[model samples]
Target: MAHVLVVEDDRPTAEAIASELRAHGYSVDTAGTGADALALAQAATPDALTLDRLLPDTDGLALLAKLREVGIHAPVLMVSALGDVDQRIAGLRAGGDDYLIKPFAPSELAVRIEVLLRRTRPEAETVLQIGRVRIDRIRREAQVAGEPVRLLQMEFKLLEFLMRHAGATVSRRMLFEQVWNYHFDPGANLINVHIARLRRKLDMPGEPSAIVTVKGEGYRFDAV
Candidate 1:
């Protein structure tokens, strides 16, 4: 069963969230303070974390920054009563994989958690193949058709992420978090620039492109 750490200062609310997750067959740990959450995260890194924007000891974003500084990359769902656009941007800018406002149903929270867990789960296969492109994760190499493709380090990471999700839509923010490991947007078209570079290397003559843009959503790697 997947484990989740719930960081909420309110005892009743925390327990309620834990119970709901438990009902869904997930093992959960609750922390009422940032310190406890940090300790638990270090000791037994949970598959995912549901963090409250406000904690008793410190700001949740501060704790999240600390976790990221120390190399904890587990998906985090930041919950806050502040539902404004700026607040949501702040949460995501602080390294959260997703953000949810308060007054939400437990079922909605559970569904969001499920998606985060699904995105972070490791794949069993070492070799990933999509269309005529093949990625050898173990060797850190990629090949197109019968030819070798030289990819930069970042390019390789980007390809691996897209291939792992195959047909799933991956937002630019998601790519920034997972690949760059930074929460805040780079304030430019850096992701697009990188994607263009990868596309140039991956596209072959007379072949359909492997990457597709989901209009208004994100990018998806064709499963074919």
Candidate 2:
């Protein structure tokens, strides 16, 4: 579950993009105004961004410069109607990670985001960190604030699940299928009980809470 920052001025379009990303277990933060979009981009701590070319307050290219100036180097997939090669080159010069024309498939948007995430991930860092929590995939180790955590088999799988989807809400059904590999009845409440226990260890007021429950949905990793 990746955290995505979406900067689109149109509300309907923003909602559509957010919904599509959420369906695949991505946590998305959207802004309609360029000022707000820049602010959100600075705070989103995203693994990527979906930005529109035309913005209300400022052009998207300028915002891209602002993002780089502030040191937010997350991969970005720019949304533009400009099809000219020179315009695309300008976008790249402005620090856009990728560009897409308007009137494109929602599925295509998702694909581009994934490609950037895969390509931009550093090869030397197999271990991922979100704040103080760390996951060492090769060693099968998860540490909390630098301390070794002793987890049951199920807990390890649950951590792995959240780590894979670091930001998006993973519905109960998806969790059941992917993490448990058990698509049992919807009546099953095992996920909730385990989640509560994990919360006690991870997010008890003074500590950081890596897991966030998305109300009617399921859960997400919120490590900013």
Per-model TM values vs. the true structure? 0.56, 0.54
lDDT of 2 by residue, 1-224 (tens): 78998899888988988888887678999989789977787666789999888997899898888888988999999898886778888887788877777776565576567657877774576687876778787777878788877667788778766766676666675567566866354676789888987776666466557798877667888884
Please provide, for model 1 over 142-185, each residue's C-alpha lDDT reduced to its tens digit, 9 standing for 90 to 100.
99886899999999999988887676677776678778976567
Minimal lDDT window, size 10, model 2: 177-186
lDDT of 1 at 154: 93
Q: What global local distance difference test value does model 2 have?
A: 0.78
Task: Indicate which candidate wins on TM-score.
Answer: 1
- How many pairs of residues collide in each model? 1, 4
Look at candidate 2 and tell me the lDDT of residue 141.
Answer: 83
TM-score of 2: 0.54
Model 1 residue runs over 4 Å out of place are: 1-76, 81-122
